[model samples]
Target: MKIVKAQDFDLRREVEYGSPEQNEAVRKIVADIKKEGDAALLRYTEKFDGMKLEAASLRVTQEELHAAYEQVEPSFVEAISAAADNIRAFHMKQKRNSWMDLQPDGSLLGQVIRPLHRVGVYVPGGKAAYPSSVLMNVIPAQVAGVPEIVMVTPPATGGKAGIDPYILVAAAEAGVNEIYRVGGAQAIAALAYGTESIAPVDKICGPGNIYVALAKREVFGAVDIDSIAGPSEIAVLADDSADPVYVAADLLSQAEHDEMASAILVTPSEQFAKACQAEVQRQLAELPRRDIAGASIEQYGAVILVGTIEEGIEVINRLAPEHFELIVDNPMGYLASIRNAGAIFLGPYSSEPVGDYFAGPNHIIPTNGTARFSSPVEVDDFIKKSSLIYYSKEALLSNGDTIMELARREGLEGHARAIEVRLLKEGKAGANDDNK
Candidate 1:
């Protein structure tokens, strides 16, 4: 890992917008799916996923869901169920009811909160199966009362014949039944524009490869997408009191995610920074994904030297990392200073994986410095809010002139006239009265 002064370090990573070829390819796939529907869907599925199937086999069967349990261990099921409960409980607190506020003027103004009618969660199904991701994406939608939660994965995982049993088990545990055996950009297209078999969804969520991300971007206006997530990131702000071993391990936790993942340590003490860098080297050699982690550490990982803990925090806020760990003498004291981070892990014991797997917060976090403005996937992502406006005759009559003035200022005569027509008809009955 490179050790650089705070002033010397450039924290921004070059955003991946996909190559021109990839973008053109995605556009073609999306357009074909839109034009051809099921025939196009199946043809692309076979061409990409190498699975030849009819439209009848598009949806996963109930027997497949039940049989998935048999493939997974009883212990695995127990653990996932517990994790699901934790996730569901945490999100349940985020649930909000549709409310109306009644004013003295007999006006009803508020928000009508309602869950999306249907949502599609795209689960990546290649070398690794993200059962935890299935839980993270599906549970929140369930908590938000999304009636139909559809899941789409590649027909095969790790070049195998069927979807990962663990992913299927996780989906079942999270209360999702509608699933399909498809993947890549085509799957995103299918979700956005309905096929003969798969119905269109209100939104799409979950992680995928470059193709999937680009597809989500292409189909965005047609259906809402959670986010076009970037590579994983973790920034650790530590003091001399922090353990080098713990700090190195936590940093590597994110680095091992991929070659593009970023892991950085911001500290004031040069001695501690050197210690953590050496520890990261030692841990990286022992990791199963050492090559991937090593690349990430070589390119993106760093130990940033700062003048003080406050300066380190300033660097952190500038980075706006996806995951942040504060390992200091008093982590709580610094919590208020942290203005940007998708998920925060305070102290030594609170590792990032705790939130990623079981601690209840969604791991589908905004990435690539997006935490500065966006947030991690929450219950709100699966729900929509419609503003409630019930202006009484008196309320409209009292406010119509102000509304018209604002509208006219914006040169919207039609908008002003719409309110003018109402006031002209109703203003005859004591328009000057303060109360109805």
Candidate 2:
């Protein structure tokens, strides 16, 4: 990790995320899946995941889901149930109802809110498994009233044949019935385009590696995808009043996620910056995942020194990090001025992992400076909105001439004529087919 002044840093030019090979590979996989369906998907699974499968065997059996519960401890089951309750309680607050407004003209105008018919959640497998991700992804969709929620995880973890038991149990507990033994870009393709076994979903949500991110970008129009999240990154905004040990531990929390993950600290106190730098090095030695965390810290970690907490806020907004922690004298006082963070944790106790696991907020957040324009995945992501406009004879007669004028001004004579038809029928316009 390096300690540097903010004036010397250019965060935007530091890194280039996805590679051409990754994009090309994903493109080829998505194309093959679209063309060959089950056959292409099966081939990819065998080639990439080392799992040979048939169309009939792709979907996880109910027996597997039930048996998964037995493999895990009772305490684990209790924990998952509690997490689900918290997640459901939080997202249920975001649920919306279809609403209409009646006009004085006896016309109706409203917005119709409806959940997606089906949704797909992709859970990463292999070296790391996040059953927490399964809960975060499915709970919001379930809250939004999505009837069909399907989950796709890789075929194996720790070189075993079946998906991780924890992930399976989490899915079963979260009310996800349809589970598929597939992953990576092929899993994304199967979700976007239906196969013989797994049906297409209206939207896909969850985080993955670069290949999965690129696949989501490619299949965007075929099915709605949550934002393309990059490597997990965290920016801690602290002042002299902050704890250096607490700051260092929270920074490494995101760093341990991936070698590409970034952990940075922004503080106005020079003493605090040096203290955190030393604390980070000391703590890095004790981590079991020291290699991964150290690599991430070496590659992407930094302590940025600024003149004041106000300047630190400017730097935070510029970075627009996925997760932000404010450890200052009064965290809430700075909230109005702080703009660009996927999730803001106030005070030292509001550590990043708290939000990652037990906290109800979605851990699947916008990453790599995308928080400037994007948002965390929520219940709204699982639903679609339709505008409703019902015009009555009285309403049309009152506003037809103005509507016709605007349409004709845009040279859309057909649009004007459509409005003129009703006006003419009601004796509100001159006898002419043209809107003029």
Q: Residue-wise lDDT of candidate 1 within 62-141, one digit each (tens)?
A: 99999999898999999999999999999999999999899999999999999999999999975468999999999898
State the displacement of the C-alpha of residue 376, model 2, in Å, after optimal TM-score superposition: 0.5
Clashes of each: 0, 0
lDDT of each: 0.92, 0.90
User: CA lDDT of 77 in candidate 1?
Assistant: 99
Model 2: per-residue Cα lDDT over 1-436, one tens digit each:
8989999977782444478888889999999999899999999999999989888999999999899988999999999899889988999999999999999999999999999999999999844899999999999998999999999988996256488989999999999989999999999999999888889999998888778889999999999999777888999999888999999999999999988899999988888899999999999999998999999999999999999999999999999999999999989999999899999999989999999988799889988788989988999999999999998888888888888888888989899888888777776763333545
Specify the highest-lDDT model's number.
1
Error of 2 at 122 (Å): 0.3
Best by TM-score: 2
Off by over 4 Å in 1: 408-413, 423-436
User: Candidate 2 local accuracy as lDDT?
Assistant: 0.90
Indicate the TM-score of model 2: 0.97
